[model samples]
Target: MNTDRFKENFLSFMNGCEFIYSEFKNGDFGDLQRVEVESFNKMGAVEFWSSGWVGIDLVDCVSGTQEISVLLSPEQRDLVDGELRRFADLMARR
Candidate 1:
């Protein structure tokens, strides 16, 4: 949950994946933000967005957006969930 550890883990997760670059309105801040992610396994041209706390798969390449409620594999989900929980705990302590 420390910044250093989070960066290390995030980099490890993202390494070797081909990330497509894009950005959009986040609705909170009046500014656009960049999104980088490995291409969608099924769609081939979509990227995922972070839901503030954790990254959730989202497709915004086409006309309508694709809401990925559950996209990651079981093992990947487990890893992400664990990391998110750790991050929350860390924030609470601060």
Candidate 2:
């Protein structure tokens, strides 16, 4: 997994974004990380896919987001859900 590309894309997506919180994990597949970015009232989860090609998905809190699949390596659906849940939880606490 080329993590350099992933980081590049992540930073691009986070343009003008105010990072609220983030999490990292050393999983069985690879090193997975979740970041919550906010711009004004817009909030979404950015999951750094470590097992596949440098890829990430944007999911709106009120809008249903599409999931991206690159290969049959592994799915980080739980991580995505967890990021959203945790982001909301953290935002609520603030």
Candidate 3:
């Protein structure tokens, strides 16, 4: 991955998306923190939870299917995934 490009895109996405944060207790993991961000156009969302995990999905508002991988390149996905994990780790410190 191109670190510079990834960082640039990740920052741009985070700045643009609608961000929400919440924390809850899990039986196995104690406290879990979650951060969710939806694309400006509402076509994609990324969910990041504590403990080194992340999820990315492209939404189809009409069909309600999540098979819209064409909206993002593999490199873009990887960049988002890595940044989310990093964000989760940062949240853990708070």
Candidate 4:
């Protein structure tokens, strides 16, 4: 995979989601590391790693907001839930 392209696309996706993201040096995936995305609504946060294709969810303690982190494999990444097909299409286009 082209790491640079993937990073660009992933960042675009995050931007489209209205989430602010940054690459942090130390994380579960080691150096070359994790992407930290915070929800614009301040409801939750997520940390994603490409190495193991993992995602972690963190929700606001007081708000009790529901947070979900889905870890998709390369193939699974292309699959879209019916309701999100349109949004998925937009993401794929990027």
Note the Cα lDDT for every prediction shown: 0.39, 0.45, 0.44, 0.41
Candidate 2 wrong stretches, greater than 4 Å: 1-15, 20-23, 53-94
Off by over 4 Å in 3: 1-11, 27-30, 43-51, 56-58, 67-94
Residue-level lDDT tens digits of model 4 in 1-94: 2234435544454454444445665565543333333444433333345453434344443556544445444455343232123322333332
User: How many clashes in candidate 2?
Assistant: 0
Tens digit of per-residue lDDT, candidate 3, span 4-57: 333454545355555565666663323444445454334453433333334455
Model 2, 1-94: lDDT tens digits are 2334434434453446666445456765466655555653445554555664223444444444433322223454434434433444433332
Q: Which regions of candidate 4 deviate over 4 angstroms?
A: 1-6, 16-32, 43-51, 56-62, 71-94
Sort the predicted structures by TM-score, highest score first.
3, 2, 4, 1
Question: What TM-score fits each model?
Answer: 0.30, 0.39, 0.40, 0.36
The stretch of ten residues in a row with the least summed lDDT in candidate 2 is 65-74
Q: In what order do the candidates fall by lDDT, top score first?
A: 2, 3, 4, 1
Q: Show where candidate 1 strays beyond 4 Å.
A: 1-8, 25-32, 39-55, 58-94
Rate residue 39 of model 1 by lDDT.
33
The residue pairs found clashing in candidate 3 are: none
Best by lDDT: 2
Clash pairs (backbone) in predicted model 4: none
